[model samples]
Target chain A: MRATEMTPNDKTNDSTEQKIFDAAHELFVQKGLDGAKMQEIADRAGINKALLHYYYRTKDKLYEMVAKSIIHQGIPIIQKTIESDLPLEEKIIKFVDFYIDLIRRNPFIPLFIISEMNKHPEQFIEKILPARLPRPEIFLKQVEDAVAAGTIRPVNPQHLLLNIISLCVFPFVARPIMQMVLGMQKTEADQFLKQRKTEVTEFIFAALRPR
Target chain B: MRATEMTPNDKTNDSTEQKIFDAAHELFVQKGLDGAKMQEIADRAGINKALLHYYYRTKDKLYEMVAKSIIHQGIPIIQKTIESDLPLEEKIIKFVDFYIDLIRRNPFIPLFIISEMNKHPEQFIEKILPARLPRPEIFLKQVEDAVAAGTIRPVNPQHLLLNIISLCVFPFVARPIMQMVLGMQKTEADQFLKQRKTEVTEFIFAALRPR
Candidate 1:
């Protein structure tokens, strides 16, 4: 049972390097950066320690690769969705859909992020920044337009952004507890969470719409 | 210095264990659980490893003490806050206040919870249920009441509750990057987070209030 063997396509010249990343990500999530070991990563990748270093030079460098991969995977969607020409409510729906899907694709993304961010937060956030989408001025404008038309109450765009994220992200981050407390089974939890895209935007708009 | 020395009024045979917990809490935050060492904990507590093992048995056991202590500190507040006769809005306000103060007092609390929770989630959740608040049904009913009375837009109460939590918790868990992104120093971050209690409650109430 080779743990680290990869298909030829996955290797390229970077195959060894890629193996190191795959191992690092798994170990990082399971045990955190400090708990993860270069030796273990080497072993997991089916390579010797020298070969592991030959690819990535250092543990920190390899970790940065994984971290960047995560941020790149998650952040661009938000930037594009919110900055799109979609309608206000539709933008929200798309935003929620984006995160819910992202979490499903990467369930550990939040825990991985929250844990590592807490460790060397300066490093994590800095890594995340260059990838940050341009301000969703369109989303903000949509929100203002809704408020002006007396469709929603006046609310800060930043706080509104916070609201959208909280509903979408929190459940996935707290899934184990949420599932237990809310009496949901695995499939049930997935379905209910998927249903949240519609539930959340309507709820927020309902709350904000002026009389 | 005599390791395991007791205070003049100390009588509990658990003093050594208590010292270990206090020391572990500080070190876990300072160096993380993995980074922290048994010897370091011993040095800080002024106790020997033999006594530590005598009380807790292993490093995991010692960590359990810290996790349990943090859980004990917060869980009752959730129960009492939810089970109380306070009005919904007031309850919301108080919960925000409680969480903010608690997180502030131990800035590392959320990170610690997320970390250990990720490490052994089944064990953690089995030990302390996040939904142990008796009669969460009451909060649910209140949300339904507001929705039915048209005092607020229709919302899944659970989603709204989740929203409030994410807004409050995420920034702290993501403190390192958030500070960099917002260009805030530690004191500035403190003030920014401090203001969130009022901001989060009002934001929810505003968004949820009847259109």
Candidate 2:
């Protein structure tokens, strides 16, 4: 049924479905698709196995839901930020700050998404990613314009986008190893990550600055 | 038994053990510790499950050995490169080129190591890593000395190190998603990555260049 047509009982059902989604997302992120068990997800949701089955018939279906939810939630925000009217340097600062904060709030998402994509890129790229994937053309064009206008040095927009993202997302993806290598505790790690927003922004601008 | 003390029959046993290790490494990287099955690994090694168990009694033991093997092989190469007497600019180029190539050849290892580390960090950080980890002190000190001498702009050496590694490693970790986003085929992806050695090196040096 459509959301506008939902009755009170449907709203109650929606809350239960949300609970299942929350539980499934947590388990999937923590243990991945193959490693996460449906029974455990049901238990985590505080619902019985039968009810969990009734809501989502299989782990695969639930996993698809969780993955879709993440993409749907993230893409719009990204599109808005990237497609914004800001200058390239300001756009980059905004992008880095926003992305670092987003990953910090959802620490496991980068690794979970990347690992799942590695395991099954056919499914992820074909099914989970919407037909209207977030387009970087506008952002790429802005980068090209910046170079032409001599606002920034000439560089490949694709690599620049990848560099910005890599700088933001990789620390979180490699957090366990980073923590171990840097000899950082949880608090220190948080502090280090907090510093990266400004650090990353400056680094990007410095790199882009015309000689 | 030590290699020097091994009997003639021990050579055959060592070869069988090597087969098990290779098969286990492949499966573990592809399927992870929980998803990879012992029987599958045994079959991949062209041995019966009994023989596999005779070589390594449990999956955990086998997984640990594989993880350690990866570390033992990689750390020395990394230490040698970082501790070399090259100038900082040359060192950064070498590090980026070597690392990107290493991950390209072993495409799955980045995600495998990061995901496995996320799953059981205490075990991975404490046990899998050798007591004498590849230290970054020499590299960090070099960055500091360069900054003090006005050879590069002032930047946190830790963040700089992280950025360099992140630029090198994150592409391989996120290759599938990157391909989908960049609308590139496998060959294109390979070409893009090949270009990154120069792209990444120039970007880092540009960022580090003194104003």
Candidate 3:
């Protein structure tokens, strides 16, 4: 097998790098950049401090790499989905479903991204985001076209977009408070989030229905 | 006047305490509990470290006071508004308008609260939140009655409440990204938030309109 052909040293190196990356990602999400420590990350990765530094020289470098990887992971999929040739209604349904599921799988991302953005807006904008962002122009124009054709009610395209994204993202961002106030267990919270896929889509369409 | 009658020492003490409180609030909002330092807060307050410690014995105590003050300031107003006897539409309009305005004035509160909740849910829920929370039962019941009376379309009351809050709060929470993606200047962001009061209310009512 190809794996057997590789040296044992190569396999160990690959696994060590994976462990460091996973540990760094988890710590960065749980604690903000300034709060997470290099030594602690090393401990969590089950490696010594020297080996961690050998792979990633500094905490900032590790954080930057992790942040970049997350953004890269999300941006392309969003761009392709929004820029697709599907009709606006279908596009929205797909976007909400995809976004909610993505956040569900990586529940910490929303809070991590938002907190980092709050702490350093310029770094988030210039360094973390790709040169070409997920273009919303296509999505905005689609909404405008829908309104012009009297397909949806006359609404500010920007506000409409914000509303849709807000409905999908806020629940996860505010999950602790949501769980506390609603008296929801972990299982119930999962069920509520799943239900939002249908509830949010229908709510947006209902609001858009011509007067 | 009562101010004129006060001893000079009393006035200075009052202002000094106010300075410490304001400085601590600013630092806590910018950096989370663990990241904020007493010496930095003292410097920002234009006081010595000894004075800061004299005023608030420990960083934990200061943080608890700030968090408690923030929750207390918001809870009563929200409770009064949501529990008011106004019609459902009027109640929603009032809630959204009041909430957006509250957040606009205190832009850091949502992120601060949510971050603290994420970091220490037990501390936030058990200690910081008042024994009596801002009750949502009345609001939820109103939504249910509206749906039953055919005044609004069939919808889960919990989902409806979440939608209204998500629309109101998410914009502020995600303002940095929103500004970047939409290419909004500070002035434009202000205008957009101001517009949401009307926009969100109308959108919610439109969605709830009987089919």
TM-score against truth, every candidate: 0.80, 0.92, 0.93
Shift of residue B10 alpha carbon in model 3, Å: 5.0
lDDT winner, 1 or 2: 2
Query: Model 2: which docking level applies?
Result: medium
Instruction: Report lDDT (CA) for all predictions.
Output: 0.72, 0.85, 0.87
lDDT (0-100) at residue A206 of candidate 1?
62
Q: Candidate 1 lDDT, tens digit per residue, B105-169?
A: 77777777767667777767776444453456778888888788887667778777766777777
Best-performing candidate as measured by lDDT: 3
Q: What is the per-residue lDDT of model 1 for residues A50-155, given as tens digits with 9 covering 90 to 100?
A: 8766666667777777777777777778778877898887777778778778887888787777777666767765664465544656777888888888776777
Between 2 and 3, whose DockQ is larger?
2
In model 1, what is chain B's TM-score? Answer: 0.84
Per-residue lDDT value at A108 in model 3: 86
Model 1 DockQ, alpha carbons vs. true complex: 0.46
Q: What TM-score should be assigned to candidate 3?
A: 0.93
In DockQ terms, which candidate is top? 2
Ranking by lDDT: 3, 2, 1
Worst 10 residues of 2 chain A by lDDT: A1-10
Per-residue CA lDDT of candidate 3, range B101-176, in tens? 9998898899999988898778778779988877788889998898899999999999999999999999999998
Q: Candidate 2 has which clashing residue pairs, if any?
A: none
